[model samples]
Target: MTETRRSEIPPTTDPRPDQQSPAASFPSADGLRFRPLAAADVEAWLELVVRIAAFEKAPWHAQRSELEAAFSDAVNPVAENSVAGVDADGGLRAFGRVVKNPGGDKAYVLGGVDPAWQRHGVGSAVLAWQEARAAERFAADGQPGARARNYVEEDNPALRALLAGAGYSVVRYFSEMLRPLVDVTAVPVPAGISIVPWTAELSEAVRLAHNEAFADHWGSEPRTAEQWAVQMTHEHLRLDLSTVAIDEAGGDVAGYQLATVDPDVEARHGRREGYTELLGVRRAWRGRGIAPAILTDAMVRFAAAGLDHAALDVDTENPSGALGLYERMGYRAQRRSMAWDKPL
Candidate 1:
């Protein structure tokens, strides 16, 4: 993700009928109304998301369950941290949300205008609401050096220009890498380590290991137990295809490769693809080839499960040299995305 700087801004309250509307700032919005999204809007939200995904050719789209989970997130409740734009008929036209990280140093801005509503000033209004809300969150938390961040696909020049105009700058680049699940090779597990299938009992241990493993990575924060629990039970997670490496002597998690399969993606792409959602090895076990071993094991299992490809995203400047490692393992960058940040 690219980082950008932001100037101080006034805080805004949640957009409700009785309060100042986010769309009111954009006179050209043509009577669009704004308010916090509620549970009843889930289906409409998914429809809007799918439309945006197709228009942008995004790598993935949100599933209904994912949206439900987001609404239930304790740190970023949908009804409080989200804004949705609707027309006279109450159809969702645009949406935005600010999600504060557990570490309180970053608030992720996510949302987009529907393809049908582009260029009518809706995008700008949505972004304005998101930035103001993110700033409000930062002020409330009293965190030093906090910033608002957004990710945009490299192919999306319109959004990139909008972010730039809003004072956001690209701070980092990420690649979505893909490798065919053919002729997968097995890498030897490190000595004194055992590759085991992911289990319900090992979920917490792996989550703890993951937090430590990524502590030094850019923009990463430890996942709270609640957040980890949500991820562990996500509808797309494929337990049978995931693997965790255990230290034989300590009986602790050394590393893990969590895999997932998005049925929607498979249907749209016409190929079953396995996504390596999270892969990490604890710092103490870094140089023992544990990462590669578990990754190889996951790939082999994916192929055995009849998957056509394996994919994962990696930060281009990862502290752990992850980009080079994935390259060596036969993955190629399919596309790039930028992370933009604005200081709060």
Candidate 2:
């Protein structure tokens, strides 16, 4: 089937077990067959993800609903750019997709492999496929200096070696920080600024503030309206636990913290943790303590909602000095994910 037509069919919620297998319908290398991913492959894709996460001792963050939505996103077109590897039993072993950035300046190469399949050529083959696809997409857009980026957990030796062998180099590091909510103190808002609960009406303003705030950040780009809306209305979003700081004098957004609660995490860990998905202070508001104040407000709100902890991810080299601020605010780095880039 053609790439554009592959994702036309709706996904199957319940993919059949591998025990009842179907004959290979695609090409093979190293005894593994490959095919373009379809919307119907979401279930199998998730199964492979769960297996990989279990072996890695981490929780899988992408939900089934999110993957399904992504497969159906007309703009992103992940299903069109993705490929999956299947083992002899017709079970999914690895999957990868290269997604072009909003402005078509770059593309993100994201993928996962079943633990048993790692180091067995599955990852290498998928990486090659993703890079080729990334180059094709970038060339189509006439983007120059096209770079393919991917993130791997800091401790994954096999995957790290695979990427390094493929000429990918470490370009960035991201830390996952966690802070206990017990006895947390909320900072008083600075004079002439107010912290207000986030509302749908403020999404666009907040999006603009986010773009402006992160403009100087490395590898950052202004999000398109569709990307911003998807993030704000994401399934895991907890609007009540989120807050935005407003400049009382001009009534414009000064800073904001958007939070989310993962039901899968709560169910698995028996504890709730509020995630600060986006936290930013506009350029004019920086150095005035707006970011910290809004973050403190988010922590207080999370605590009030009975959440035991709050979490956020930060780039180690953030131009805004966010790492030190988070540390001083009682957050500790729990783990890290490292970004790798390969020029195509």
Candidate 3:
């Protein structure tokens, strides 16, 4: 999905303390010039994301605070991050950003162009420049391979065409599924199934379990305890809104469903949505209905908190057939977004 304020979970820049992304082509284009984005560009950049999402028929709920957080070291022009464009008539008409590249002998592309400003040699120039920058950065560190790779949604014909025409091919596919809070309940816990809140005392355990669950995910990255603390301790967080399923006797995280109600989301969507952002069941715990059970708990909690709905994304073709699960629970298809990439 396109990076929205709600889905700003950026790819990890470096998986470990010793890893890094490569610099690229920075290959100069004919007319379009490359430049780093300024702080003032944050507002405009976010607006662009919203407009593009709408253009794709998936309008996301983003907040001003989230936008401001985007232009920082975490999201800005680090070796792993990029912002490039040209000023026509003293104003920006085109823009694109590249996320962290998976550093190796091969290179990766975590970037995209505004559809409205496509063609006219703009995208090519920008991409060429990125390749140059990637190569340059790698040279500074004296590394090899670092080839660039990117993933495109199978259903996004437009992006598929653009990347293919530009030398990119579909490599992998994922599904976006949802879980409706319809007929939610605090179902009776099976003998070993225990509901646990991510309280201050359980933070470390919860974080460890989350990391383990996502370890096999494509492009997974390691996160430090401090980083987990930073997010869980957000000033606006409502701890009561989250639930982590545990194996009480085994002391392991089996399934989890973290919920949130962004003020911006509620205001924009005109409904109190108890958004289920992260819902997962460990690989070994699958098929026992652990995931649906956690989701149901979230929906019921949200309903009790005055929420109108609960939503989440699942890879369309997940072995789990997550889409069928949500559909059975009353969640509807809302929108879709795509990604495009080419090797350097």
Per TM-score, the best of the predicted structures is 1
Q: Is candidate 2 or candidate 3 better by lDDT?
A: 2
* 1 or 3, greater by TM-score: 1
Clashes of each: 10, 0, 35
Instruction: Order candidates by lDDT, high to low.
Output: 1, 2, 3
- Give me candidate 2's TM-score against the actual structure: 0.86
lDDT of 1 at 269: 74
Q: Looking at candidate 2, what is the lDDT of residue 96?
A: 78
Candidate 1 ranges with C-alpha deviation above 4 Å: 1-28, 144-146
Cα TM-score per model: 0.90, 0.86, 0.73
Encode model 1's per-residue lDDT on 1-344: one tens digit a residue.
11111100112222223221222232226768888888999999999999999998877766676677776665566766788889999999988887775445778888889998898888888887777777666665666676888888899988999999999999988888889888678899889999999999999888788778877778776666666766666678899999889999989898888888887767677778898888888888888998888888988898888888998888898878888998998999988888899986
Stretches of candidate 3 off by over 4 Å are 1-32, 61-80, 86-90, 101-116, 132-158, 178-180, 226-239, 262-272, 283-288, 320-341
Between candidates 2 and 3, name the one with more favorable TM-score.
2
lDDT of 3 by residue, 13-88 (tens): 2333443454444434455566665667667666766665555544343345544443543422343446556555
